[model samples]
Target: MTATLIFLLLFLLGLFLALRPLLGPKEPFPEPPRREELLEELEVLKREVEALEGEEKKLALARMVELERALEGYRPPEPRPFNPLPVALVLGAVVLLGVGLWRYTLPRLPGETTVTARAEARELKALSDKAKKTGAVEDLLAWGRKAFELGVYEQAAEAYMEVLKKDPRNVEAVRRVGILLFLSGRPEEARLFLEIAQHAEPMAAEGWLFLGNLYFQEGRYQEAIAAWERYLEMGGEARERVQGLIAMARAQAQGGKDGKSVYQARCAACHGARGEGGVGPRLQGNPILKAKEAVREIVLQGRGTMPAVPLAPEELSALLDYLDSL
Candidate 1:
């Protein structure tokens, strides 16, 4: 409303300026020639009367009266000055139109639009910076979560990282960062942080499950199985499905020829070829039969201290086949 008033005032001012020249005083037109002609006739009659005798004087007087009556019947045109109001109004309207055009049309130009957009962007940036500096941890976290929800991974990661730094033991922050890292192709780093969080708070089933998935990604089938089993032991509820996975792995391990060979090439790298523990858990015994579901789940997922390995389905199948045979 205020903006509208200002625009109206400006338009009025422009109109007034345009019309001012027309408002000044104007000169009146000259009187008609009839008046001057009548005056000259009267002077001629006076001279004739002066020259006439008594009878001639009476006749002259009668002629003068007739002339006066004729003169009275002959009306002179009234003198008039030109009115400037109409011209002033036209000029004022033109000025108003020009001002209206300028105000409404100028901002639509590409350059002006670009400038306006840039200014808006700068203002937003300033507000964001201010919020980051002054807002509370919870507020920042909420904002970060909102960004994450919007699929702005980089912004979400930054927010989660800050939260982690501020409160290393924050389970939610740790989990969020881990997920972000995993999605960003940093599964190894994600696994590390997730494991730390799980160890810090073992009761968190989601953390354990996520850890198990990471171990599985790393090809530590036995470890993956172990983590999942632990999650279950801690009251995780996916028992039937987990058991089914365990049965499949055992059958494959028993049937495949490369079981021992694959184990030597891959499994030995961590757990040693002979089923003895090295960088990872021991593989010997019916640990598969004993901890079958647990082992499969752990290998399929991942656990603390292990990074996720990008294994193809066939490779995972073969590796599981080998672990089962062992």
Candidate 2:
């Protein structure tokens, strides 16, 4: 409603500016220099002609005659006929254009009649109605998930909160609320909630992913690496982006090049910064380092969700040395 009012005011203001010059000023059209005044001047000239004699008098009489002839020839200019049709037509067109843009050109807000949006709204309505009648956890969850997908955050929150009230241990509700908190910019609070969700359901890969994001934002590189590793360990699908994130975090953690830095940069994200088990198995006490050739093969030809990570020969040697030390 506020947006509509603002658009309308702007349109009206533009119309006023456009019409102002053509409508002219409010003061009365300056009286057209008065025909009576011209006649009075002619009379004065005639009197002067009578008072004078000879050539001057003849010249004055000629000037008076000229003024009289001018007066005789003068006609008041015709007033412009005011036809309202053109103005009405222009105004009508503006209104039609405005209406057309509002109805069609501009994007409609969600839940306001696009086919997909309407279908989703109907589904949500049915879910909401079912939730209200049954007060069932499943119905509430369905409502919350559907609402969230439609970008109806408030409704999603409401449904999730209801679920939480009924079942405080509901990991789905807890995880989604944590995500909502993260999106709403309360990262500290988001961390607490996401931690709770993670502990509640360790296999929820999305919780671990977001937890990693939160830790990364706080510059906790090791924890971020751990969380993302856990996400991958649990079979999260966004492997490539997470691998990049892990690489960047490791570089930040190890500020210069060396065996340790190379290991951190190349392998820490999946295998853990300290090599405690993560997406990749624990290497801290593993026998894998004894088989360097096999490790090199795996590094060159990625297996499963892991992509091949190319490294310079020197860097690879340093990383292997670092792993042996671990």
Candidate 3:
């Protein structure tokens, strides 16, 4: 709206400026040079010539004759006629330009057609058509997972729903639907569905993660921590972030401890005092942090030659949070 108004104002200003010279005040033009003044000057030169004697007198008389002749012959230069063609052309161009600018700048009205932004939807539709043609569970699940990854919630939900319809016991489908429900703000239903999925697949890291998040949102800090712990134990890769989440939850559950202290005490020996790496892999800018759940699982179960170093839940939480910062 503001842009449109500004364009309109600019167009009006251009129009006014273009017309100002042509439509100026009607004051009479300045008087042309008077012939009488030239005549008087010539008469003065004639008197001076009479007073002079010698070559100066002859030059003066000659100049006086030239001036008299000029006065008699002089006529004002003719005014060039005003040509309206240039102004008309300029006005025509301005009008055309203003119309073009206005057309482009004006806001679109409601219900007006525009290029659609439904690439994901179109892709999902193709996947659905394929699933329908094949009538295969794997194909449906494939579409569901892809849709979820793309954040096409409706399509993901539809695919998952279809999976559930075919196999009610499909834990992955149930877990995903629960996640979608949680995202859609139906927490109570989400909890029921998530619990069912988690119960069916206790070692499913993703399910536990979602359940933990759900518990956290409900202020069930202890439950959230326990769920996240199970997720880590089950080899979830988002360990660093989940550990920080646990630390935050613990702070809400019981007064929090300094995460740095936990890191120095528990991790500094193996991971280095500054997390630059020692006996263990470098913690600074670690790729595992990017896959934090995987990192959490490694911490919980121990990886390669590293022994599982368990601490109090609070301390573990703090340590995870500290490591994530590194």
Task: Name the top lDDT candidate.
Answer: 2
Query: What's the lDDT for candidate 2?
Result: 0.81
lDDT of 3 by residue, 99-146 (tens): 766455433433322223244445667888898788689999989987
Arranged by TM-score with the best first, the candidates are 2, 3, 1
**Model 2, position 89: C-alpha lDDT score:** 66
Clashing pairs in 3: 236-293, 236-294, 237-292, 237-293, 237-294, 238-292, 238-293, 238-294, 239-292, 239-293
lDDT measured at residue 268 in model 3 versus the true structure, 0 to 100: 82
Candidate 2: clashing pairs of residues? none
Residue 221 displacement in candidate 3 (angstroms): 1.0
- Local distance difference test, each candidate: 0.66, 0.81, 0.80
Full ranking by lDDT: 2, 3, 1
Residue 222, model 1: Cα distance from true site in angstroms: 1.8
1-326 per-residue lDDT for model 1 (tens digits):
34446667776776776666657556487544476677687789888788888988998888888778767777855655767776667677767766665554433322233445445444434544654886656755775676566556776788778777777778777877887787788888999878777777535665667676677666556566677777777776777766565554444433433446455655578887677778987776645536655755666677787554445566666667667666
Instruction: Please give the RMSD to the true structure for each candidate, in Å.
Output: 18.7, 10.5, 17.4
Better of 1 and 2 by lDDT: 2
